[model samples]
Target: METSGAPQTRGARLHHPELSTLVHTSRFHAGRQPGATAVICEDRRLTYADLHHRSNRFAHALTAAGLAEGDRVAYLGKESEHYYEALFACAKTGTVLVPVNWRLTAPEVAHILQDSGTRLLLLEDAFTPTVEGMATEPPETVVRLGSLATWSSRYDDTEPEFEATPDTPVAQLYTSGTTGLPKGVVLAHRTFFAIRDRMAAAGVDWIDWRAGDIALIGIPGFHVGGLWWATQNFNAGTTVVAMRAFAARQAVDLIRDLGITTACVVPAMLRMMLTEPGVGAEDFTTLRKIVYGGSPISEALLEESLTVVDCDFAQIYGLTETGNTAVCLPPAAHVPGSPLMQAAGRPYPGVRVKTIDARGRELPPGEVGEVCLHTPARMVEYWGLPDRTAETLVDGWIHTGDAGHLDEDGYLFLRDRIKDAILVAGENVYPAEIENTLESHPQVAEAVVVGAPDERWGEYVHAFVVPVSGPPPTARDLHAFLVPRLASFKLPARYELVDAVPRNPSGKILRRELRDRFWSGAARNVN
Candidate 1:
């Protein structure tokens, strides 16, 4: 068996030419190293050969059911080997894979399916009722996760005849809708491999894959980070261990037992694993690197991680539109007490980043403005939304609604968010979504949502509500009302019943005024 390890030559392709697309990536590995481990999810272990054959069978099944190029297929379930098989099946058949977060409410799931024009839905058995309750227009075909193997078995394990281009849309990931409705972000096959190719050409090992290295997928497949990390490992012909869902104790056990070499996680996940009961340095002996992002790591937590983990720590910063990570704080700058610790590192090779003022003019270093990024890994567009796409992606640069300044040396320091999205344990929660739900309550006349700093979970949702003429509803009353409509992460941890919300002369609710109360003593408004 021949496995392509870490890239060794500068200005060379990361892998063979055949690995351009996800379908070709699977075929290349299966042909070169058939028996190599591809994915390990709980009790299930799938080899490269198995993955290739199973995905081929699923692809055949999809095509047999009339799904053709550019069709959308959604997967609503926990992370598992079947999910990867479905993903590769979509890649092979030239269909778009829409991964729905299982934690979402039924209405949320339905919105993604309807919004994406999903033709088929592959879901877990537990969510059967969830789909059945979608009285409105649902997916045309629904296949339970357990029956997929049996259903796909009727077809032969032959590769699909269709070939997807490098620019072909393969995945459509939904973002937490900043405007009360989530939008699907369409990503091409190139988004996964472009950064690796750039890194190989630049001879950089900031985030590298090596021979005999087993990687852990701490993030879920529903997020771009998890999918990108998994594909990066598969492209390198390395083994991957995926958890159905992230659990701190299971992560610690996997690191200790599976000889896991590298893992990608968020700061909150790292904190949980580090603080897991009976966890210590001895359990992380085989771990080599931890790539963390989604939220910045506090100095106290970073110091504790450095002392206990005894491994290299790297930070990644980007949005779903940037295909997970465009800026990486490499391990070389992980020195404790150094000023660089507070900065988000420079862009990867073949990537460009800059800050711009409200007038759309580029700003010089030391000037705070909206952060923008341009990379080969950028998403194609927000599905079915031309105006939204134009507003976000201007002149090939993604206008990340984040407020930050670039230092003289090019290290990016994040100050706050230009938009009103809350970061709850690395999950994006829009304020408008929560405010809309709160205002739906009969007793609530008006509502304002904001993000409040917290030691755990990074930030918690805080809501201010104005009641009707009669009696006002308590925080508990609103919490109970929202439980069925909103995801737990988006629910406000604290609520204040006010006679009137602070507003400007134009009747625009003053969110910053209410938000400033919680962040008065904090160094930066964003947690």
Candidate 2:
């Protein structure tokens, strides 16, 4: 209904259809282009027709198992053809898909399931032990990937009856919480379609898509990078080649062997790919476009990737709440001398971005402030947190809690998080959890964790600790103790023994002072 841009308007429609619109699109494309490949998983290949039929079967199976339209289904598995089928099946049945991060601990997985009120879970057999040991029993329907035959037989007799409306919830993505626990961000079909349409209008060209075009998706499907890119390409009738897990050599091999033309990866992943042995010119010849995001890519890494991949590189910026990419630095802007490359690029079509001060007053161009957004692509709300939702969304703008400035040229430059959260390797590391864990140590009196610039990862977690009774625990000791308590990525990388943490008169840790050390020579405060 909203018409903010041209290409978006062409894709937009007045009717609110069900989430199954994706399935319908797949079927329509298949019927029109039956021979077109829709997915490629290692040795397996599936046409659009194959995907449609399989997803229908999967949807029917889900319905017969007593799963209804509003039920939450958690997917805890790696990227594969099956993952796509499950996602489309959920969309077809109007069930919400909640993809669990494979890196999380058993407890973290259980927490997500319970928090999201998931009734059914679809998992790969490899993770059977992990799921079986969870504290709470998810819904009785636990379908393992390898045993689909047994599960599918249980529901084959039931008739397929599924209809999804545009208002139906499509996904509930959980974000790393800064205060307490992670919160599920509820997103509807309209939000997804709006973002997809906006992205297509801004730069994506589906016409370039062809039967032979192969997309290598190296990032985990649990993350937005892999999930959205795969979906968009699949809808366009392109073959998507997924890697179960990210390995630099494996990715290069896929490009060389599979003739993959496009791929999505983070800067860290790109760095690792360049470091792989035998990584050379020919390994990258098949690649035409390499999309990198999730964190700022240093000029050095960007240049290195250009040399290794021989492809146009594009940068995207957004969070889970913004429906993947709200701002994109197009591939043409990757010119070595282009000043725009230093910015996060312009806002995606139909996405309006503005900088606002603490009082919510709009700031003039080039002035740093909280970055807020107005877009139909924005999440409906943070699930079960009305007060938090109100705090974030006001007057149709979603306060990003990110500090940035928009230049006169309309390029966005990020400074820091308005909420003072830390980003390490593109993963959010909240200081509250680290400080709480450190303070729990009997030998420590007080603790503060902050982000420090690192060449490898965008930032690394640094902890400042004050001894209580005996000598403060060593860095190794603290890391060992925290590894089991928190996600590995959330653990502090460096430990600084200090008499006291720098704090304000009101007793708030001065994270700015800690950040200054690493960013002293950088043009921007952000690493």
Per-prediction TM-score to the true structure, in the order listed: 0.80, 0.76
Q: How many steric overlaps are in each model, in order?
A: 0, 4
Candidate 1 residue lDDT tens string, 257-372: 99998999987688789877899999999988899988655665677788998888889999899999999989999998897877888899999999999899999998878899
- Write down the TM-score for model 1: 0.80
- Candidate 1: which stretches are off by over 4 Å? 1-18, 420-527
- Lowest-sum lDDT 10-residue window in model 1: 1-10
- True-vs-predicted CA distance for residue 258, candidate 1, Å: 0.5
**On a 0 to 1 TM-score scale, where does candidate 2 land against the true structure?**
0.76
Candidate-wise lDDT, in order: 0.86, 0.73
What local lDDT does model 2 show for residue 404? 84
Q: How well does candidate 2 score on lDDT at residue 309?
A: 73
What would you estimate as the lDDT of candidate 1? 0.86
